[model samples]
Structures are given as C-alpha cells and as structure tokens.
Target: MRIEKEVSPEYEIPAVLQHIEARGRRPVLIFENVRNLNGTRSGLPVVINLFGARERLADALGTTVARLPLDYVAREKPLAPVVVDRAAAPVKQVVRTGADADLYELPVLTHHEMDLGPYLTSPSVWVRDLETGWTNCGILRVYVSGPRQMVVNFNIARHTFHYFQKYKAAKRDVPIVLVMGHHPAFYLGAQTKLLADEPHIIGGVMGEPLELAPSETWGSDIMVPAAADIVVEAEMSHSQLEIEGPFGEYTQYYGGQKLSPVAQVRAITRRKDAMYLDIMPGRADHLLLDAPMVEAYLYNRLKDVVPGVTAVHMPVSGTARLHAYIQMRKTNDGEPRTAIASALSSDYRLKHVVVVDEDVNIFDDAQVLWAIATRSQWDRDLLVLPGMMGTTLDPSADDILTAKGGIDATRPIDPHQFAMKLCIPEAVLSRVRLEDYLTPEGLRRL
Candidate 1:
C-alpha cells in the first residue's frame, strides 16, 4: 500500500518498466517528475500497476482472491452517493477552465510501438442514462488526440456504448468525466458487471461511501468522484467521429484503427499535486484489473445454473479473457459438459473453458493442465460450437465470429482408477519442514 515517490527526474515510460523489473513484481508505483515525449518534465506525478499483483488486489477488497466473488455478491445493493462541497473535495483543489485545461501538461505515457499516441489508459468513464438519468461508470481505453480532444473506443457489447447510443439518438452530446487515481477499490468497483447503479454500491461494499462533487461544466446532475486525483470533463459529440486505436490491447495484439466517438474536453480539475494513473496495456496490470471481475461474473452466473460450482479462475496465461477454468463438485454424469456450456454462454469473450473437479486447483496452470491430461478423452469430453460471436481482439476470429470449445476435464462419475491423486499422509506432512531439515546456507542455495 506504500507509494514510491522518489522517482528520478529523467524517468519516463521505459524507466517505469525498468522499476517494475528491478523490484521483481512490486504492485504499486508512484513516480514524480515524469518525462514526456518532448524531453520536458510534467509537474504531475504518475502511478502505474496499482493492481498488478493478486495479493494487492485481494488486500484492496479486504478479502482473499478466492473469496472475492462471495464478497462481491454480498454487496450488490446500491448506496446513494453523498454530495460534497467543492471545497471539501480533494480533486477540486485546483480547477482549470478554458485555455488552462490543457491535456498536454499531463504525463500520459505511450506504452507500445504500435500505439497511436499517449493514452489515458486507466480513466473511469462516468456517464448518465439519457432517459432514466441513472449513472453508469466503467473503464474505457482513451486516446489523447489533442489538448482539448480525445478519441474513445466504445465496444458495442459494453454498457457505456449503449448509454452513448441513447445520447446519439436523442441528438445530444454525451457528458462524461474521466476520473483518474483513487483507491484501487474504486477502479475494481468500476469494472464490475452491475445490474443497478455501480459507483456508490461498489463503494458501500468496499466499506466506504463514494463522495461526489458537481462537474464544472455538466452541472450538479453529473457527479464525479471527489477522491480522484484528476478529473477531465468532456462531451462526446453525437455526430462527430474520429479514428481511434491501433493501440495494444489486453489481448496482446494491436486493436485495429476504427472510426470512433470524439470527446471534446470542457474543463480539467485536479489536486494541486495530482497523481496520474496509467494501465500498461497487454501487461499484468491490465489482465489483473479485468480477470477478477470476469471471475466474479462467471462465478455468479454459474452458481445459478450449476449449483455445485466451487470456483472460477481466468488464468493470466490466457490473457484473463479468452480462457477460463471452472472447478465444480461433480455428482451427475453430464454435469461437466453442462457446466462448460453454461460457462461459455456466460461470456462471449471466453473462447475456451475447462471444467475440472473440486480437487483441481484452478489457480495453478500445472494442476489444471494435469487434470485435463489425465481425465479427459478428446472424443467424449470435448464440446465445440462454431461461428459464435466472440471478442474482436482475438486474431484467430473471422471478424467477431469464432469457434468456441470446452473440455470436461473432470473424472468419470463412478471412477475407479482416476478418482484419487497420490498424496503424502497428513501425519507425515505436519512433521516436515524444509527449513528445519536444511542449514541456512543450504536453504539459501535452494
């Protein structure tokens, strides 16, 4: 939870990666004097990889990773947001309007070679439903195109796009506030698949109420998180479109350029010493941010369909989107196949799913692979559905349609041979300690 602030003045995007590498998986980084492309220092500090590690994310939610789903489900009720005075809001400490609201002053990083330009990778986009006046918050990739303009990629499948469509239909510009830098729980809550109002409910579950402040341009009806380090007030024009992307995505591939919505910045508000946040696309930070949310969503969906579902894990190796592992207690003959089908149907982004017995550790790739290798029979256990709508980021897909498959890796219902795995007795395991058996030097070598 400690923020590292003694960053070198010359440090830039490459230096951030070097720091991550040097620290050997430190979860949070806060850099001061971040160098921009113009070889000048930005006054604002930068933060990256806030949720890069599993342990850090777990700590943020006040629970273990294995118990996050239960924790998330328990806090589904919305808590009304408390409106705070502009003076009481930390984010409103310094407000810039008109010409002073320049985006170039921020140290937004260019993450990869194929990326178009500096992107505000971790902005929590806030928008309201045109008809209902209900607020919606979610994370979207934004390309910084100009001082007062940015291009936003809105995938039609996401709720944010639906909200934008309503605004477009009404012939009105969509008012949005792109919030950056808050407690990790705020970011995690924003990513949740909510059936109701998200921001306050998520905050309530995280043991706090989300404080709100009125937008400078959008009025009191449109609120942004008061705790944010920086807030960009913008309006996505109903008719204007701009070329966005060719930026690296979580799928580890360049998301091709397409005509997308153009946002015109109206004002910028920040703390006097604002800390900018950026998510490294196609890296651990991006995957960790998305994976836990997907796992929680799948866990909730499967529990209703398959009552015996034990756990769900979207492995990091699969980029935490395209592949999934579901652990369940099998009682019936066709339960594994049923679980697989239900899981695949839960999320279109999932291209492959492996259903394993409760004995298998879904978090461990080796254990899941071992279960599939030993228990599965290709002809009988494999389930394939072709021409299904899938993630556009998947390179193998034919335009958004792709084949989906699943493996029933659980052992047979009345198994004789493959039912049990060999293990050491508890009595022997309890008495054994590697550190007690080895010398300090030997332990160090090991």
Candidate 2:
C-alpha cells in the first residue's frame, strides 16, 4: 500500500501533553477543527509541525531519537523504499477542489501572537530528485494565502530554494507536493543531511518505498504522499507576489514577516478524517527541526574522524545546531581537534563545538563545562576558524559575515593525574530526599 493507516493523531497528543506538563515546552498536536479570523470551521484537518520533540523526532525515523547511528543499520548501501499507486493510498481517501479549497477555513493557529497568518507547518514537501526523477520529500514550511494558495519561504541558499530557482530561471513552476500530515519522520527525513538523493533515504528509513500518485494539478511530473491530509498542487508566476511574515521562528526570535512569492493551489487530497499536525512555532517544534539533521551529519563525520566517536549531542537548549558537544574516546590529542573540525565543517549553522573524552557524556552541559574549566588551557586547546559558513540568524553572526569557532574541550591528557569522581548511591537519595532540607511545613516553621 502507498500509505499505512494504523495510528491516529489523538494517540500522539497525550505524549505531547506529558512533555509540556514536565518540561514547560511547546509542541501541540491540535486535532480540532481550525478557524480563521472569520471563525469558520472547516471539515479538513491539517498537521502543522511534526518536529516538536526528540521522542516525536525518533517516532519520525521509526527509532528512538537517542539511538546513535552506530547502534543499528549500515549505510554501506542504503535500501530503497517501496512505492505504490494512489488507489492504495490512504491520504487520497478524499480530495478538495479549487472552489471548495478555502485555506483560511482550516484553523491554522497563529502560534505566537506575532505570526504571518496560519502557515502549513507539517509538510514533508516532495520535489523531483536533482539527479534522477525520484521524488524527494522534505519538511518545509509554506505560508497559507487566501482561498487556494500558499507562499513557500524556501530561504536564501537553501537546497529547496536552489531547486525552485532552477525552475524559476526557466520560467517554470516547480512541481511540488507538501505532504500535509504524516509521521514525524517524514518531516525529519526532509531535514536530513543533504548528501546524495534523499528520496531513497526515505526508503531506507521506512525500510520500504513510499506509494505515490501523479499530481493531477501539475502536468504529470509531480508526485506526493498519497495519504497526505492535503496535497497543495500549484504553479508559480513571476507576476504573483504578496507580503508574508512577522512570524516567530525556530531561533525563538520574531522575524517581521515580509512579502514573498505566490503559487495558486489547484488541488488538495487527503484522508476524509485526516489529522492536522500543528507545531506552535518558537517552541520545541522549531528546535527539534534541526537537531536530528545536525545529529545525522555529526554522526557520519565523527565516525570517520575519531576512532570511537560513539555519540554527539547538539543540545536542543543550545538552539539546535548552534552549540554542539561530541562524545569520543581519548585515543590521542589529534582526535578531538579532528572531531571539532568535522563538526564545524559539517554544519555551517554551528557557533561552537566542545569535544570530550568518552568518560564525559557530551549531553551533560555541566560535565562539558567542567572539562573546559579544568582540563582546557584556553589559548592552547581552542580552535577558531574565521570567515567560515554559519547561519545569519545567529545573533553572534550579526556582524554580517560568515564567522565560526570551536573548542577542543577535551583534557590534554596527562594519564597519571586523571581521576573519576564517585557518586552517592540512589538508595541514599531515596532515604534522604530534597524535602528533608526544604519541606513545605518546615519552611513556615523556620
């Protein structure tokens, strides 16, 4: 079958609720009928942002997000995903038309009070493979226009933008499909390291190929998630334009929305009872978007450079790819530098990198800082590469140039002086909890 239909969005909502209840983070799976400023409820439902949590992120890849690449699978030869036709596709169960297609009718939340309007958040957008004709599905945010249209903000120097630009240069509309709703992985797959053709990588992740249907809206060339909640098929024109954003972005910063290009959405196909995925911007949704993408690149690079670079943590709290900590064995002095260099080069978006010995879990910021404080002698251990590629969104890069830096946070080894700290037993903690020191009743007594 082109699409499998077992799980429901409702099943995933509780997981998000628990995450928010515990962490005070943002990752809402809104299944309710969405309304616009006009307050009109629509029958069609859409899933906005799927990259909302590390767990959901893993759910996207069909594995635990914490699982390192070394734990399973070999990339020696990636397996191709299986594909089927629209007849077997659950996403195409129902289809919306041009007149009936009122985008504002769907309750696309204005996540933060400052948003460009309701945007299409959970789209594993499919485009033609640059090399072959295979379709490449990647999560990209497309802004909603009035009736039957969206404005895609493909961003400067992005691969998607480049692909569309190729078509734009030729005065052709880039045939595309924004898979409205699907597993978190569909979005995660799109955020993957841009290496070879990625549609096949989706096959590798699914352990099978996807079923696809020819986009009737586009002339025979476009195909999409057959089971998508919506397939917004439209073409572009040099004449069409609109002022778009003022939305909260992944950086947890407000980007004043501006005018962008326009495309007329001719057709939208979906499951009759499809779930709309909405990821409130400026929350975990934004951070998780780039984490695994950054992780995948680090995983591959570190493995080749460091002898046993088991894991790498680009802490979400660190703004996705900006700051990263790499876990590697203390093979020698060169390995840490190699890891740092690999990380800096792998992700142009990064600000700093801290490489540490295997004894230190890179995920622990305190431990990493501890290593930096004690073992590192600032001038000697640090490495800074100026004029390298990095994200302009970075406040540090506000100098308006591509600048980057990294730290070999690992201890310059003097094997004899090393000592591992001992930890108190958990049983002891159970015997004497924090309540003993600061009790609700005792506080008043004090």
Candidate 3:
C-alpha cells in the first residue's frame, strides 16, 4: 500500500510500521512522499515489509508454505549466472560517480527508537574470495556515516569476514558491491547455508540462471545482479576500522557499538525509476528470510540420523536461530535422546531443542510446551551441554559460548503406555462445519 502522506526518514517511517505491526498486519508499504536525509523530497519510493509474510516467501519459491523447507533443500543445485552488458542491465541505466553519487539523496531509515542513525538494512554485500575467486554474498547491516562513507559489520564467523581476513593479510582493499532491491527469491537464495558461489545458489532457488552485469567500479571481475533496482560500488579499507552500531538487531535488542571496516563509496547506479528497499529490523521481514534455510538444514541433518523425523520448525520467538522444535515418530524410548544429541550438535546457533511426537504440531508453541510439561521428568528428559559454541549476537551467550539445552517431549511409543491426549472425534469434526453452524456475519466476525 502506498502512503501519499509526507513522512521523514528519521523516525516517522519506522514508527508507522511499528503501529501496523502492533495490529498484526504485514503489508508491503511504499512511502511515496518521503524526505531524504538532506531534507529533499526523494524521487524514488521506499519499499518496506516485503518479506514479512511466509505465504509471499513461499510464492517466491513457487511452493506452498508447508513445503517451503523441503522444496528449498530439494533445489540446492548450482546454476551459473548469465552475464549481460551494461546496456542490457536495468541497474546501470542511471549511473552516478564521484561527487554526484551522494548517499544522502536516498531515503534511508532509522528503525528502532535507540538505533544509532539511518541504516541500509537490506543490501546484499558481495565480495570475491581471494583464494577461490567465488563471490560471497552477505545481507549485512550498514551504517551510513557520511555522504560517501559507510561502515559494514563483516561478522568474523561469516564467509564475508573470512574473505575480508584474507584481503587484510594481503594488505589489499576489498572491492565490494551492495546490491539492493532485487526479487524476494534473490535475497532468499543469498541466505543459503551452503558455502558456494552464491549467485549459482541464488539461480537454483530462482529456478533459472540469474542475470549478471559488470560492476561499474571493478568491471567483469566483480559482476552484480543485472536487474537490481540499486547498486552501490565501494572499496572496503583493509586498515581503517570505524565504530559502527548500537543498532537494533534481529534478536529484538540493540547491538552495541563495535569496530568495523569503513567502506568508501565510489559509484552509485540504479534504474531511472527505482524503489529503495528496507527490511524492518527485529521483525518478521528480517527474521523470516533465514527461517526456510535454517529449518531445511536442520531437518536434513536430523533425517540423516533419525529416519522417523517428520518436521522441524525454527520458531519466531527464538529469533529463528536460538531454538528449534522437532517432530518425529518414535520407535524406541532412546530415540528422543539420540535426536536431541544430533540436533544440538547440528548447528552452533541452536541453543535449545524440543523433540515431540509426530501427533503434536511443531509449528504451534503451546502444543510443544504442553508436551514438555506432561511427557517427561526434567531429571530424565532434559538435556544440557555447557560451554558450547554459539552466535555472538545472542545476548544470553557468554561472548560466543553458551549452554545448549533440549527436552525430549515425546510420550511412550505404545498408545496404552502413557495417558491419552484428549481429541474431538473425526466424525464430529467432519460433520460440524463452522460455516453451517454460524451465520455468515458471525463467520465474518470470527
């Protein structure tokens, strides 16, 4: 929905989005009349909350929400990108360099109340690995410090940081491109856990080869998405590290100031009519992008050890990283402990795992919690491993090490071995339709 009312990039835009979120609506928002940082009306519209809904994300993969995780795992084959010339690239239509390429002209937004300042939340920063020559893509937070300078957090554990370390060792500045405003599938593909040429993985997720074009600064050596709405070509300094954040992160908390590499913007290219895309931090749009990939990876890993594993869900309550709920058909009493051990060791970021019977819905939090409460005693079923590697972003973590815990919330394999769960008869459920029992207006109210 396009809002014709005028808004500022400072706090107004994000405040409006927060209000919308409170009402439990995640519609794509277009701020048509937005004031840029320089207090000038922006020609380009700002797009927010594009990835807020699972149904839309599923649509991007050409699958249903229920099958999204499995579908993603099934389509992991790499497909090379097809390179196109500058003339054929939509993102190259309007190129600005030197003094004309001003970052202040764009409608960058400040998301949370305590956020440092306006940030570019959705750019997929691309850098080539020094040894392998593979292009690594990371959706990192960028703090726009000046008209031509920005600070990027090259996380030490991520592929970008690993490549950055090599560049630093060689004493060479890293050439990078911040790709913005591409299709949802493009971003989803970039979030794959597989350590490979990301464009190939992106193409496989897109179900075809992605189009690439020579970057304005590095030419053929560093190709970027040909159809991207906006591209910022820059060089990250190997020596210069700047203080970066106190910015709101995906964990629904502020990430304190830290030293990061400063990127000097060389050029800005975009379509004549482009949309500035922003991912609402600490919300569904920011978290859901990684959900499918994480769920798929965990599910595949669990299935290898336990064939009876039915599904896996990374709940939003855990920021889609720290926790997982696994559902399986248990064959023996020891299966739960085996699954718990395998799952906790599967991913470093996973701090908690809850294994339940197949009959319980893994997607529903209440059902999973209920199973935990009734199924087993804490002394026997609770699994805790201290001093495990975890994400540094986790506020609860002791730096990067955390205590991982799990609960085997499954009942006895035999139906009569444990107390039975209450359920309405299938005959009654099939016969008593809500539509038939209630008035049309009553149904609408419900």
Candidate 4:
C-alpha cells in the first residue's frame, strides 16, 4: 500500500491488482523507506520496481495481455503538453541546485553484481531531434558515475542511437531530460512503436491529459507529473565516450559491460520528499515492460497478415520479448506462415514467432505445444529464415545477426473427405466435470 498514497488513483489499484493476478510470483510492491545513499541525507521510502508476471503487467496497463494489442488500434495520440512555470510545479516543491543537486545522495540501486555502479534502470528520457524537431520519449539505462555523470547505453538502432548519431556527426553534445517516479501509464506510453512524437497518449488512456511542467534548469521540455519525484537535465558529448557495461539486461543474461557514451548531468530537480524508484535491471523489470508491449505490437502487425488473428501471447519464459505465440483463424492453408513473416518483420526484437489456430490458447504454452505435437508435421509446419537482425539485448544474436524459425501448429483440414472430420460435442465439454479426479481438492486416496 506504500504506492497508494504517493501514486495516482489509477496506478495504486492496478499495482495491487498486479500482485493478485500473479497470485504468488507477481512483483512485490515496496513500501516507503528512504535511505540516503550518502550516509547523511536519505530519500523518502516510495514504492517502485513493479514487474515480472503477466498479471503484474496486465495490472499496469489496466487490461489483460489478450486485449492490450487491440487497444493500440485506438491510437490515442497525445497532444504536446503546454509548459507551466516552476513555481506552479509540485515537483519543484523542493529544488536542489548545482552541487546540492548531487545525484549520489539518491538511493539509486546497483542491480546486478557486475554493474559499474548504481543505475537508473527504468527512465523515460525526453529529448528532441535537432534537424527534425521531433520530440523523443523512450527508455534507456543510466549509470551513476559521479554527482553529475551517468553512463548511457543506446542500442545501435534505438531512437537514442539516431539522436546520438546526429550529435556525433555534428561534434556537438546533446542535452536531454531524464524523468523517473511518476505514473506507470507514462511507461506504457513510452513503449509505443509509432514513428511520431507523443507524450499525450497517457491522457488518451486516462481519458484526460497529463499535466506537465518546464524544468527550472532546462527550458521548454516538460517533465512528467508536473511534479516528478526526480528529474535530471543531462548533456551527452558525442566525442567524450566511456565504458558503460557488464550490467545485467532484459535478455536475462549479462550484457557483459560495454564502453559507451556518458551523460553529463548539468542540474537535477527533485521534490524534497522524493522517493527514488529502483528497478532491477533484468527479469521482472524486463517482463513488465516487454510483455504488454509485445502483446500489443505483434497483434497490430499480424492482424492483416493473417485473417482471424485474435491474440498475441508473450509468455513470461520467452522473456516476453524474444518469443511470441500468435493465434489466428485459419481461413486458408498458408495463413500461419504469412502471420509469422509479418510478425518477424514487425519488430527487430522478436526472435521466434509461432502462429496457431483459434482452438489453442495463445497464452498457454502447454496448449500451443500440444497443437504442435498433434496437428503439425515437422517438414510442413516449420519455417526457418537465415540471417535476420537481432535485438540489442539478445546476447544469443551476437549483435549482428541470427536465424529465425516459426511453427504452424494448427490442425490441418483435409482437402478431401472433409465431411468425416470429427470433434467433441460442445455440450459434453461444458457439462462433464470430473470432480472426483480432475479437481485437486476432490482427489483423495481414502
């Protein structure tokens, strides 16, 4: 319940519901207990780092995994926020300037044993492209090295990569905003795959707009909540690079320490009552962010590719990013392969995607495997493509390339003598319940 008081009404209940949905394995909510990292000043305890199970992610999005992708079709584009003054901002309720703004004092977590230092794992960095005037909001890892220095890891293909490339090409340092400790909805909005700039998707999802405020230290660009718990205004020098790695990653493996660009913090603005949110780099954090996003994007990508495309399930074991289970109506014979091709091309992140019939629950891997066993012939259903691009965190992909494979697990209809096809009666399935053996509580040796 620590999150209830500090978080908005929408975030609080869903956070708790995340636990309920997972039953036992869901992410645990941290209650407030601020410990100052400097041994002198401490941050206020706040709830943070919620993720892992599908139920947990579903809670964050306020929907089930099954429905999330369809929601993207709604495409509620957020309007660029109107900037407000610092005095009017609740985030400035307690402002720390220059050295007083030392980030070392915040209780940032050093997630993996090999991490260079304490890192800000979950952040929605807001910046603008120089030539295009396009505002960017996306997630990247930030490692705290000094009071004013943090290391940034930008994937070669990420928006940050393009932005950084621009700066590097011009030999100019780029200044940007790093925001944390706000609504989970903000994180959801940042996951969007659209090429356009949108901070207003939060408003559309919430049925209203989110309030934003300008940074006292930086100009124009508004940070989240109009009162974010912690905001860092940072500049990145394209020429001045540093090694930024050996950190654990979403891929569930060590990213093995990387030498990357450094973020020079110019000024940090925060609430006196700020509670730093520490998201562990791997596992849970990766799941919550990846699952719902994959569910939404894959569905959107494969919808028109295969008719009767109903749901996309990114099970927890697949890291929710690497593997996807696609469900569709098999209107024709080659439909599954078509769905697989579209899905693979949709996002560079997906390594393997399987398309199954409506009878199989995409969410349950067991049923999917069952369909593969009963309905598919190895040669007929399997499709493997050579030399595909891999995601940044896909350690298995070697950063350069990897192979792609998919299975068509739906039962094939007979082209001839189809009238003899058989199935169980719906009424029998609905009415027959073996309470004596099937139910755990019903089974007793005595």
Candidate 5:
C-alpha cells in the first residue's frame, strides 16, 4: 500500500503498523512522501514491514508456511556467486564518495517512542576473515550518528564479532559492506549457521547464483550484491567505540546503552530509485525473519539425537528467541530430555524448551498448553540447568548467564497406559462441513 499523505519517519511509521497489527493485518507499506531526518521530503520511498508475515516469507521461498523450515534446510547448500560488471549492477547507478555520501538524504526511521535517534534497521553487514578469507554476513542494528558515521551493535557470539576481534587484535580497520533492500532470500541465506562464504549460501536459498559486483571502495577484494537496492561501503574502527542504543530490540524491550564499534562511511551506492527498507523492530517483522532459520537448525540438530522429532516451533509469544516447542513421536521416555539438552546447547538465546508428543499441534498455543498441563509433572518431567551462558538481551538474565528450563509434556508410548484424549470420531469430523451447517450471517459473524 502506498501512502500519498506525508508521514514522519520518527514513530509515525511504526505507529501506523502497530495499529494494523492490532487489527490482525500485516501489509507491506510504502510511504511515498516520507520526511527525512533533516525534515525534507525524501526522493526515495520508504518500505516497512516487508517480511511481517510468515505466509509472505514462505511464498517468497516458493513453499507453504508449514513446509518452510524443511524446505530451507533442504536447499541450504552452497552455490557460488557470479560476478557482474559495474554497468550491470543497479546499485552502482548512483555512487557518492566521501563528503557527498549524506545519510540524512534517506528516510532513516526512529521506530519506538524512546529511540535515541534515526536507525538503519535492515542492514546485512558483510565482513571477511583475514586468515581464511571466508565472508560472514549478519543482520545487525545500526544507529545513524551522523551523515558519515554510524554505530553498529554486534553480538559477541556472532561471527561478525569474531572477525572484528581479529581485526582489533591486529589494530587494523575492518572492511565492511552493508547491503540493504534485496530479495528476501538474500537476507534468509545470511542466517545460515554454517561457517562458510555466505554469498554461496545466499545463492542456494535464491535457487540461482547470486550476482556479485566489485565494490567501488575495495574493488575486487570486497564484493557487494549486484541486485541490492543500496550498498554502503564503510570501515569499522579497531580502537574507537561510541555510545549506542537504548534502542528497541527483537525481544520487545529496550536494549540498554553501551559502547559499540563505530563505522566510518566511506561511500554510498544505490539504484537510481532506491527504496529505503526498515524492519519494525520488536515486532513480527524483526522476529519472524530469523524464526524459520532457527526452527530448521533445531529440527536438524534434534534429528541426530532424537530421530522421531516431527516439528519445531519458536512461538511469537516467546519473542521467537526465548522459548522453543519440539514435537516428536517418542519411542522411549529419554528422548524428550535428550532433545531438550541438544536444543538448549545449540543456541545461547534459547531459555526454555517444551517437548510434546506428535499428537499435539505444537503451532497452537492452546494445544501445547494442554499437553503441558495434562502430561507433565514438575518433579518428573522438568529439566533445569542453572548458570548457563545466554544472551544478555534477555531481561531476566544475570549478566551473560541465565537458567535454562525444559518440560517433557509427552505421555507414555502405549496408548492404553494413559487416559484417552477427548476427540470426535474421524468419520464424523471428516463428514461435517462448517460452511454447509452455518448460515451466511453466522459465517460472517465468525
């Protein structure tokens, strides 16, 4: 939807999206008349909530929502990138170097009411290892501090931080390229857990080779996606640190202010008519971007320890990072505990895991809750590990350590050993049609 009416980048865009979410709709919004941070109408349009719904992501991957995780896992193999000339790269159409590269020309958004200032919410930062030359890609938050400078928040556990450490140890600046506004597959591929060149993985997810173009700043040594709408070439300082954030995060809470690495913007390049993309932080758009990737990773990990694992879900209620629900066809009582341990160890951000039987619909909150209430006994089914390393973003964590807990909400394998669940006969359920039974008015009311 295109909004012809003028909208301020600060809070107004997010406020409109929040109201739409309350009404149970998430649509891609295009603000044609968005005011820049400098209070001038931006020539480029602003796109928000592009990946707000799971169905849209699935559609982008050419699959149904139910099959998204498995599909991602199956197609996540590495495929090399094909390089293209500058003339063929749309992002190189308009290049600005040094002082001419003004960030305020774009509509950078201030998402929440308390945000420090305008932020670039959808940057996929790319950096390469000095020794192995393996490139790492990560979607990181950037605070727009000035026209030529920005502060980047990098998680210590992530590869970007690891590469930054190597650069810092050598007292050398880290060469970085921030790619913005590409196909959803480009971002999805960057979420791979594998430690390899990410452009190849991006190609795999896109089902075609990712086209690369030599960077104007670093030339052939560093390449940017040829099809990206905007690409910012910058260098991360080795010794410089700046105060960044009190910014809204994926956990639906504000991350406290801390010193973070500063990036000096050297050049900016984009398509002639680039669209500024912003994800609604602490909302479905931010959380769901990583949900399917995490689910697929966990599902693959659980299969090694528990072969009967049927499905995995990271519910939105848990902010898609804190809680996980695993569905499995249990052969023995020990599998649930094993799955929990494997899952909890796989990611530091996960705090809780609930293992349920295959009969339970793990996607439905009510059914999963019912399984927990009916089948789990705290004394027998609960598993807790204290003082585990976890993300500090978790508000409940004590510094970098937090407790991890899990529940085995599965009944015995033998059906006759436990009380039978209430269910309608399959024959009757299959025959009954709600559309046939209900009147038009009744259906409309529903």
Candidate 6:
C-alpha cells in the first residue's frame, strides 16, 4: 500500500503507463500536475493502480494473497464507524461550493478508445436506504457528464440500485457521497456483499474504524470517510436520467450505452493537496479487487450446505466474477455435484463452476484444467442448467438469460482408481539447493 509520488510537469494516461513501465510494473503511482482535456495542468493529483499488484494488496490486508479469503471471512462482522469533527478531518481542509464546484478540474481519465468521456473509475458511492435508514456503500462506475453532473450506473441486483428504487418511488432525490482515495481496505470493503452489516465495518475489521465526516451538502446523516483524499457530495435525481456508457468494463468489453441515473454535484471537498484515485477498466486491478470478497462470500454460503468445503477461487481468466472453482473434501459420491450446483446458485454471475478434490490447487489454472482432463467423464460428470438468469455484462447472454454448466472434476469415490501424481521424495527435495551445485546462469535458466 506504499505509494510512489511522481513530480511530473504534466499527467496523462500514456504518462502513467510509462511511469509504471519505468518502475518495472510497480503497483501504485501518484502523479502531481495532472493535465485536463484542454492540456492545461490541474491542481489536483491522481493516483492510479493502487491495488494493481497482488503482493501490494496482500500487504494492505496484513496477510499473504493465499490467506486473504479466510482472513476476510474470519473478520466479517459489523463494527460501527466513528464520526470525527469537521475541523479535525483531513478531507475537510478545503471546501469548494457554488461556482467552484467543477468536476472538470479533476483529472478524470478516458481509459479506452470507445469510452464516452472521462470517467471516475474508483469512487465508492455511499447512500442510505429510504425504508430502513441503513447506510450502504458500493464501488459503482461514474461517467463525468458535465461540470457538476455525472451519470451513475447501477446493476439491478446491487443493493445501491434497490435504495435508488425506493427514492424513485417516493419521487425524491437520493443523497449520495462519492468517496475517493482511502485505504485499499476501504475499496475492498465496498465490494463485499453483506446482508446485515454495512461496508465501512469491513474497514474497522481490517484495521481501525473508518473516521466519518458529515457531507457539507447532504446533511449529517450522509457520512463519508474523513481521511479520504476527495469527497463529492451529490444527489441522484429520481426523475432525471441520461445515457451513460459504451465504457469499458471488467469483462473486457464495452458496456453499451444505456440510460442511467444522474447525480448532480452539490459540493466538492478535499484536502489542500488531494490525490484522485483511478482504476483501469478491464484489468488485473479491477478483477482482483473484488475476487477475495466474492470468494469469501461463496465460502461462507457453501460451508453451511457442504461441511467439507475448503477453498473457493474465482480465477482472473473468468474476469474474477463469472467463473468459479470449488475445492472440497468429498465424504460421499454426491457431494461434488451438490457443491457444483451450490456454487452456481451462490453467485448469479457465475456461468461455469468446477468442483475438484482438495488435492488439486484451485489457484493454479493448469492444475484445475488437468483435473478436469483426467478425473472427469463428459457424459456422467457434466451438469447443465438452461435459461438461468445471468449477468448483464456477459455479451454472450441473450437478454441476460443464459445456459450455465458445471463440471464435477472429483475422482470417483467408490473404486478410487485415479493414478497418484508422481513427485520427488520430500526429504530429498528439501535437502537439495541449487546454490550447492549449479552456477548462477544455470540456476537462472532452470
């Protein structure tokens, strides 16, 4: 989570990529003097790829990448956020209202060729439920539309969309706060799907309780992270809507233009020198950021039905959302099939699920594929569910309904005829060190 600040005279998307390449693919980069669309320098700095690398993400969570899901599940309880005085909040150092509330001044990036315009790629939106008064936060996409207006797209199934629906029914503007640049834990927490608890509680579980500050325009009930680099206090118009996309998504495809809710900015608050965070669409950072949360959710759900469930992996190849791999210890013959069905049901976005024994490493794509090749019988082990509700982002789906399938890659439980994988003896393998016999060049080649 350590960021390297660059004192560049000008900032652009290409320059950010160049900086990443120069640093040999470093995770985080903070750029000062970000250039606007007119090629004029802006006062605000921009932070990109903050959670790009797995090692950096692991460091942020205080655990190794392999242990992130288990750790997250263990600490997935609600811890109330602490409200701090506006005078003590770093984000309240400078307040821009009325004429100064201009979204164009920030360095929003046009990430792809077909993008509609510059987009705020890393804003975690905060909204309150109209019926329950419970606060909800989600990392949703925002397209910059004007000086004080932006289009916020929400999936119909997401909780944020549900809250917006309530406001739409009541015919009132839904107050919202767009939080940018806080701890990586906050970003990960925003993606978590909690039924009872709020998202900010995940931050408290990870490290400390998130410090809250009342939004200047949205009243005291609408809270934002006090330590955030930037906060956009806005309200979503219940009746007014606009066409918002053709922007790149995590699925590596352009989400076609659609009418989305518009949020008109009432105020913009930030520190004297704020860092605006941006995430690249359809990239590793976008995928892995939500992967651990999804895995933890599936693990929690599956453990209740299948007691032997051990691990869940949503590989990056599946965009870390649409495909799943479940590893479990099979006590009976029907367990693998049940696990496969349960996995597909657990996440509606999942189109393909593969259940394997604990012996296979789900993280390794090759090993999982190998298990399917050797352990699965196409006719007997495959289960297909047709005309199921699928993700809207899936290009192949017809009207968001598609046929999904699962593969039970676990070996037969009766005879146990699968051949054992050959490996060198543990004692001998542990004793051998390349430095003892090989040259540096030879070791590198090996």
Largest TM-score belongs to which candidate? 3
Please report, in order, the local distance difference test score of every candidate based on alpha carbons: 0.83, 0.64, 0.90, 0.69, 0.92, 0.82
Segments in model 3 whose C-alpha atoms lie over 4 Å from true places: none
lDDT of 4 at 107: 59
For each candidate, what TM-score against the reference?
A: 0.93, 0.81, 0.96, 0.84, 0.95, 0.91
TM-score of 1: 0.93
Listed per candidate, the RMSD to the true structure in angstroms reads: 2.7, 6.6, 1.5, 5.7, 1.8, 3.2
For model 1, how big is the CA root-mean-square deviation? 2.7
Candidate with the greatest lDDT versus the true structure: 5
Candidate 2: clashing residue pairs, number: 27
Error of 6 at 1 (Å): 12
Which stretches of candidate 5 lie above 4 Å from their native place?
438-446
Tens digit of lDDT per residue, candidate 3, span 110-220? Answer: 887888788999999999999999988889889999999999986777899999999999999999999999989999988877899999988998888999999888888
Per-residue CA lDDT of model 1 for 300-378, tens digit only, reads 7898888889999998789999999999997886887888888888899999999998889999999999998998999
TM-score of 3: 0.96
Task: Tell me how candidate 4 scores on lDDT.
Answer: 0.69
Candidate 4 per-residue C-alpha lDDT over 142-249 given as tens digits, one digit per residue, 9 for 90 to 100 = 878887788887776678788778888999888778877776666667766666665666555544566678665655553545757778888877887788877777
User: How large an RMSD does model 6 have?
Assistant: 3.2
lDDT: worst 10-residue window of model 6? 2-11
Residue 8 miss distance in model 4 (angstroms): 28
Name the 10 consecutive residues with the lowest summed lDDT in model 3.
152-161
Assess candidate 4 and give its TM-score to the true structure: 0.84
Residue 9 in candidate 1, Cα distance off native in Å: 12
- Identify the superior model by lDDT, candidate 3 or candidate 5: 5
